[model samples]
Target: MTSEVMIQSKFTKRFSKALMSLTLLSSLFSSTVHAHFQEIIPSSDIVESAEQRSLTLDLTFTHPMELGPVMDMAQPKVLDVITPEGRASLLGNLSLSSQSGEAKRYQASYQIKKPGDHIFYIEPAPYWEPSEGVMIVHHTKVVVDALNGKANWDALVGAPVEIEPLTRPYGLWTGNLFQGIVKKHGKPVPFAEVEVEWRNDGSVTVPFESYITQVFKADANGVFSYVMPKAGWWGFAALVEADEKMKNPEGNLVPVEEGGLIWVRTRDMK
Candidate 1:
């Protein structure tokens, strides 16, 4: 080969290696930095009339701010609704409803029979995150009030790791403050890290990566608080390393991220 052609071939090889390195770095940074939320969003937070008794909840595991890049979610180990009366399993109500090329999602249709707070919670199966090398299990919950029945909104679904809301968690103004206690096995977890994100509805623009997810730490008593400034569904996830490691898909032991998440919505007071 000519000397000029040899030089061009070497340059192209070097450029390709450099580009591959950049791509790998970018993927690693995104996987580790971006927040993952297990969402359980109800059709309505407050049910008033007869027509609104039927509620639909969309369940997915994804980056809430980015609104996409969803992860495949296996059927949850537990799915139930806790009310003033009692707790009832809703796993049979779940149906596969995933979009093309996206992760497996679930949609549940629930009929409100009584007047009270309906607390729906889920314990999703462990998702193996290859980028972070950890298994993620988020126990998520959302509350929907039926016919002005607001009792027992703070009821617990008895998760291994959970966020016990100090606030009512529903029917609030945009500027209202939300407080919750991070709990593990019904006990408080001091200084637990909590990540918060706003579910983008294709209207807001994220100016920077930092703006995508907001984070905070629980106090000495495992209590954290934040004020909602936007009128949409906000998800708060309290995350901590699990006491026990789980086997990965490769049959190797890996750390587990036990997260307790809760969802609430606010309005602009129109």
Candidate 2:
């Protein structure tokens, strides 16, 4: 072949290979960069008499549905419980703890003093993610109903971002519709995006990346709904970019991703 033609052919081959590499790299990154959820999982969702009122809560930063590569969590900025009467700080009771293959998790125990729905919430300290070049802070919460109390299950705890449940946060059955309004700074965010996932307990397996989490968009009123497909704990995270920025570990200002998360449990009807 002519020199010019040979050179052109080689150039084309090199360019094609480079483009293929870029495409594969993009696909691999997209599959792994999933939604991180702040889990405020309790030992039990329902507290009966004072004997059963005490519950232990574990705070972990990770992908609950996938349950791997647990993100290191710093001490939370705020942790509190809101009852029918008022809100009280529970941070003093939190103790730094870790689990197998994970570090920097937290645990707390609280005793129910009255018949009311107790909402446990935490605003985790910002975590720097070098992969995304941003810091993430999730305002995560869960509810424990005491003696069938319905009060305070729907109360807002003034989180920077939060999911205000429209459906009763407890006593849900599988296939029941779960609805909540995505609020940021006490205002509705139109067309907010939410990620939903079920906490896996080693009985289930996901064959594809898409099966790890489900995404939905809120309506004009900042309300979204989903039906739980299984009998387990489900978490809904409404993510939004904060107006403020925080410095990352690299000492550079980066965008903050504020995730408003809430967890609820569903049981199958016999």
Candidate 3:
């Protein structure tokens, strides 16, 4: 063969080999990416009591990664409740709120009125790929008591509730700086609103301009805490605004006087 033809043949062989190597690398990378995308963690379920006699539903999702900033807002999770009669009730209409950091959790609550056995479940959807086929639904049974009466004024009031401070010594604001729990009638009231106000020394109380208020929902065990800001003599009170649409176990709207105040004091600020 001519030297010129030999050199051309060698160059062609080298070029073909390089192209094949690049193709193989691309395929391997595509497969790795696909595998990562397919991985998904299972979800969790929670059942809560909205009132002494009513039940609330909570559902949470576990994702493989941080779920990207955009999808974080979407908070894709499906929730449903099966009535005692075996009727499937869709939970999509309920308001969904999420908190994400070290852990991501979604919460929604609906009042269950009838005194019977009800099933709550988390249905799987396409936001995150589930390892199991179609994600088996996980659920819990909740019981409502028919004899419980509407929440009383004393049972809905709170006192001496210490809240966590907002600003740390380093001037960093931790999201849930509040850290204290309030209870009424020996049961933890989750997601109840607490208001704080600074009062003058005189019997006549002047509300401080820098008042703090927060709405906190209790955990599954009906417990919560809030950080108290710079501590001093401050009037604190716990209140749960009555929901006219919500009926107590006795089928009556929970009642509380509007603008009601349950006074207590926080002495030491830490």
Candidate 2 residue 70 Cα shift, in angstroms, is 0.9
lDDT of 3 by residue, 1-270 (tens): 999999999999999999999998886654323211111111211223444443344333321122212222233343444444444544554445454453344455555565433334343232322221121111112122223323111221122221221221111132324333445444456665554443323333324312222234555444444554433222233444332333333454444311112122233324
Better of 1 and 2 by lDDT: 1
TM-score of each: 0.98, 0.88, 0.26
Q: lDDT by residue for model 1 over 31-127, one digit each (tens)? A: 8999899999998999999889899889999998997788899999989999988899999999988867767999999999989999999999999
Candidate 2: residue 195 Cα off by (Å): 0.2
lDDT of 2 by residue, 1-270 (tens): 999999999999999999999998896686446878899999989887778978899998988888765888889999999998889998999997796676689999898888889999999999887768789999999998898765778889899999999998888999999999999999999999999999998889899988998998999999999999999999999999999999998789999999999999999999
Model 3, position 86, has a per-residue lDDT of: 45
Q: After superposition, how far is residue 257 of candidate 1 from its true place, in Å?
A: 0.1
Rank candidates by lDDT, best first.
Answer: 1, 2, 3
Clash count in backbone of candidate 1: 0
Score candidate 2 by lDDT.
Answer: 0.90
Which ranges of candidate 2 are over 4 A from the true structure? 1-32, 99-101
Residue runs of model 1 more than 4 Å from their true location after superposition: none
The TM-score obtained by model 1 is: 0.98
- Clash pairs of candidate 2? none
